[model samples]
Target: MRLGAIADDVTGACDLAGRVAEAGLPTTVLLPAPPAPGHPSPTTEHHEDVFAGGDDASACAVVALKVRTAPVGQAVDEATAAAQLLLDAGASLLYQKYCSTFDSTPAGNIGPIADALVALAGADGTVGTPATPGARRTQYEGILFADGVPLAESPMRDHPLTPMRDSSVVRLLAAQTAAPVSLVPWEAVQRGAAEVASAIGAGHTLVDALTEGDLDVIAAAILSAPRPVVAAGGAGVGTALARAAVAASGQRVDISRSQLPEVPVTGRLLLAGSASAATRAQTAAFAGERHTLDPLALATDDRALDRLRDALAARADHREPVLIGSAPEVARAQAELGAERAAALIEGALAELAAFAVHELGYSHLLVAGGETSGAVTARLGVQRLLVGQQVAPGVPWAVARSGEREIALLLKSGNFGGPGLFTDAWEVAP
Candidate 1:
């Protein structure tokens, strides 16, 4: 594999994988194997041959892990194993993909996990940024900006899991890792890769990137640095990495796997579990039959699951697309059942609903929003890997995965990604 990406979440993995695929490199999203006998994380030895059935050399392999909100020690161990998996798969470049918003608590899964990957690669240092210009997320002067406003003042500050109250990337990362955190100013970056490389030292350096041009420069510098190239950033970096790899190796994207394939859009079902403003807007703008999941009802009532199943059955009978998600009153549910419990309840319920829509109802196309929810649904459906396909939005795509004997088309979207019309417009563009 040319690029081995370790994403902190499932949607983020698909986001990065899609970017790589767009750059002419076939990409695969691999989920970690089931946990060992009594272990919580899968080891490198245990995950061998994970890429055996997928694209080998000249392709990108991304290991998606649901460790974005996991505890520190556990997150580090799991991310490190994924790093080892990519390295063992003969990936010369290792990219750590996280949310474009740099979602994390003061006690991080990002900082510590990046540190683990760095140590494992035995690299002198690394350059990192979360500037995905396509998503309107950029970094300048070491501060992260979303849609022209600082991240602290954005909607992400109200995020239930990892409320990003600080806009300074240097400070956010420095608070979680002992390594010296520094910045490579836009002045240096604009001068080209050599200037950026010269500013990079023996620690984590944050680079400024406000546009695609800046990303290409940064990617070039990272790829030409030295052996075992290790870098960390959002999906923007993944796109740049693929372009750089192709330029250096002269490998072309496998055309057969890059484009959308002919697939039936019958039995379409849209399941969303994110409380993000984008998803709420999408749910409201959707012009179709829909059902709202009530966390409180699901937690306390026995008939809630039955009602949801029945709703799916009705949708299946008509072969119509439906949007099913929890109400936007997550705070109220969290207040009553605690944050973790409420999240688990919703994720579990959505996973079960996805299984029913597929296995029981014969749904062929599944559109899922949110990271944890996508992870749960994929796990419940027993999907081991996903082949990157046509994109529906900036970071969301329609990929194919197998569950038993069924070929299911999945469109996994991050909560903060896509437009308000996504839930409705996605169907019009499906292959």
Candidate 2:
């Protein structure tokens, strides 16, 4: 594998994998596998031959993990193992994919995991920039901006898990790793790729990217540097990495996966659990029959689950697209039932609803919006891996996974991704 990616969440993995596929390098996002004792290390080739079965698979693989908010020690161990396996797969480059806003607590999985991966790779240092301009997240002068506003002042402050209350990436990472946090501003990056190489050679574990151009600089420098350096960030970074790989090699490898079949307008079910403003807006502006389940009602009412299933089933019978979600009042429910309990209730309920929709309601396509929600739904459906297909939109794809004897289509979207018409426009022809 030429490029091996490790994403902190399922949506983020799909986002990165889609970006890689768009760049002409066939990529597969594998579900997390337990690091079993005495088991042969899972390589990119082995995973593609087994889970990602199809035509000749490319040399890029993305592994998605649910360790975004796990305990620090556990996160570190798993990341180290992932890095070792990717290296074993013969990938010359490793990218740690996270949220565009660099979502993590002061006591972090980001910093600690970076430390472990870097130590395992025996690299000079790891770069830090989650600037996915497609998602409206950028960094300049060491501060992260979300839609032109500081992250702390954005809607993410209300996030239930790993609320980003800080805008300075350097400060946030400093508290988690002992490595010296350095900033490579846009000015230095614009000077040329050589400056970026100099910074990495001198040991700058963290850098800054203000726009798409800056990502090019970082990628070029890393790919041509004297010593190997690990690239880290969101889908934007993956784009630049693809460009750098092609530029350095002076060619694009052949890939066989064709565009997905035309997406049918009906028999589609949208399930959203993200509480972010983007998701809330998309949910409210849904063009299909919308049913917003109240968490309180879902938790207290004995028949709430059955009622939701019946409502979705009715839509299926009529051949109409449906949007069923519990995203209206997450904070209120969290306040009533506590954060952990409320989140668990919502995730569990949505996973159950999705299972019924796919197997019993006969929905062919499933759309999920959120990280924890996707993890729960995929786990409940017993999907061990996913076969990537064409793009539904930027950072969104129409992938297929096996559930029993059926192959179900899916689109997993991150909280901050997609525009206002995302829910409605998702049914449009694949790009």
In candidate 1 the C-alpha lDDT for residue 112 amounts to 90
The per-model lDDT (C-alpha) reads 0.85, 0.76
TM-score of each: 0.95, 0.90
Candidate 1: C-alpha RMSD after superposition? 2.1
Rate residue 319 of model 2 by lDDT.
49
lDDT by residue (tens digit), candidate 1, 1-431: 36788998899999998777777887888887656787868544634665565334337788989899999988988888888888887887788898999999899788898888889999865686999999999999999999899999999998888989999998998898888888999889999998887778777888999999999999888866754447899999779878877787797675435545466766888899999989999999998888888889988899998998997786535457888988888899999998888999999999999999889888898899999999999988988788787678888877888888988889888999999999988877665
Residue-level lDDT of model 2, residues 1-431, one tens digit each, is 38888888888888888777777776777775544576533223335342234564555777877678878877777666666667776777888887888889998788887777777778877875888777788888888999999999998876888888989988988888888778787788888888877777333355577777888888887777778677787788788888776666676643334754344433677888888888889887886688877778877998988888888776635346688788566778888988878778888888999889778866677889988888888877867677676666678876777767767778888877888888888766432
Q: How well does candidate 1 match the true structure in TM-score terms?
A: 0.95
Worst 10 residues of 2 by lDDT: 42-51
